[model samples]
Target: MKLAWLRSLESAHQDCVWACTWVPATDRSGGLLLTGSLDETVKLWNPEDLSVVRTNTGHCLGVVSVAAHPSGRIAASASMDSFIRVFDVESNNTIATLEAPPSEVWQMQFDPRGTTLAVAGGSSASVKLWDTAEWKLVSTLSIPRPEGAKPSDKGSSKKFVLSVAWSPSGRQLACGSMDGSISVFDVQRAKFLHHLEGHTMPVRSLAYSPLDPRVLVSGSDDECIHMYDAEGKTLFSSMSGHSSWVLSVDVSPDGAAIASGSSDRTVRLWDPKMRAAVQTMTNHTDQVWGVKFEAVGGGARGSLLASVSDDKSISLYNYS
Candidate 1:
């Protein structure tokens, strides 16, 4: 398994490209690349040619996260000011605008079944779930504070949530916090389960294996990637190689590998069985904020990987 350079688009966005995700193919269209940037625009690109399909604006204070629904017809983007714009992919028409005051939004994701949108609620120490049909706030999955720790304790507020991931089953959700701990929750029950602990810095990314429901991968500011058993609440492996903060992470379609982007300006592929980094691509000149695998892959293309950076560029690679 290795990554072959395919193509790169320099200055893909005017400012930092903070997030990227592959929109799955639908009956009416092929898969497309969705990206959010610090320039306050969310753009869709033709993955085949890296051409702009559409440039979506209306966000303020920089767009930081973008998520595609399982249906491929809808996408939601969140900006630094905590505003979420949910819109149709083809028409670019606004579907809904969501906001939760007193709780800033960081990362957002749609569940595999397309029923709800889960958002990382920054500073609120919770993950908010929204019903897709009604476009209404449904639940807030809050992290349980340590016993005897008062709400007045300064350290308690640092549990600001930064990232979240839904398991393959969608029955469970995992959220990463600035205080360096991962909290897993039972979605149906809206209950906090346990914390996966190891990294001592903020965890900026989280991914669940598509094949194994129990496996969860995380990247943190501590410059390490850790894989955990979400069900068992145990750290399975910790791989360290990046020289700076690991900003983003994703598991491949086959679940055989994990890919990560870092402040070190590199993207790395890790083998879970060996607990080691198998390959590293130093293709970006600045911090790499996002690395995503094409959700579904086959044919001659095999699997496609995309890395977006603070350099305002996007790089594509063929994973085989």
Candidate 2:
């Protein structure tokens, strides 16, 4: 697979852009890109030309994560203030405002079937699930503390969850934490299955291969990306090239390549088979915050990848 720089929008937001997701196409509109920033606003863009479609405001603090429902009709954005806003993608109408206090929200994702939304609960050391139909809190998958740690032990906070991802089949969920361990859980049983350990620093991002449910990829503050057998609980390989923290990582829809954004100010595309970076794009002058592949749909739009950075810019690329 190869990536060709397509376009970029400078100053897309007033501050650092931290999160982005693809809003699938609907009958009334084609697929659009949604991005959130430290500026406290979420903006929708027409990828065809990287033009602004709409800007959503009212987020209290820097937006930490953004997720799109499978139906393409709605999307959710979460901020550092611990609030989640679920709204209509087209009309921008508010659907629901969700929060689980004392459980700060970090990353969020909707299940493949769109029945539930899973959020990474920081400090609480758990993953919170919300029923989409009623927008009600359904379950909390708390991480098990270490054997010698007490419930009130200060070291337990080291497991503060930072990112969450769902397996393609939606049967399993994985959450990454500040201490670098990843907790895998069985969604149907709502039980913790196992923990995958390798990185020594905070794991800031996680993504499961869309084509392989067992293959999971993670980026960490240690400046490396590790691929794991999600179901088998084994480390497949580790790739290191970034000079600074790897902020975000995403597997291509075709699963042929993995893309990562790093604080080193570059976006690197990796060949998972070779376990090495094949190319790096260095257009952004600051830390890269997020990278995402467009989830395929019935529309004829070609394969696309997007990256946002602390430089207040969004870059688009054609992936083939």
Number of the top TM-score candidate:
1
Instruction: List runs of model 2 lying over 4 Å from the truth.
Output: 146-155, 297-302
Stretches of candidate 1 off by over 4 Å are: 146-155
Write candidate 2's Cα lDDT for 36-72 as tens digits: 9999999999998999998999688889899999889
What TM value does model 1 have? 0.97
lDDT of 2 at 293: 93
How does residue 46 of candidate 2 score in lDDT?
99
Local error of candidate 2 at 54, Å?
1.2
lDDT values, one for every candidate = 0.92, 0.92
lDDT of 1 at 131: 98
Q: List the residue pairs that clash in candidate 1.
A: none
Tens-digit lDDT string for candidate 1 (1-320) = 78998999999999999999988889999999999999999999998889999999878779989999999999999998768999999999999999866438889999999999999998888899999998999999988764444777544756899999999999999999998889999999998888888888999999999999999999999999999999998997999999999999999988999999999999999998998999999989999999999955556767899999999999999998
lDDT of 2 at 224: 94
The CA lDDT at 37 in model 1 is 96
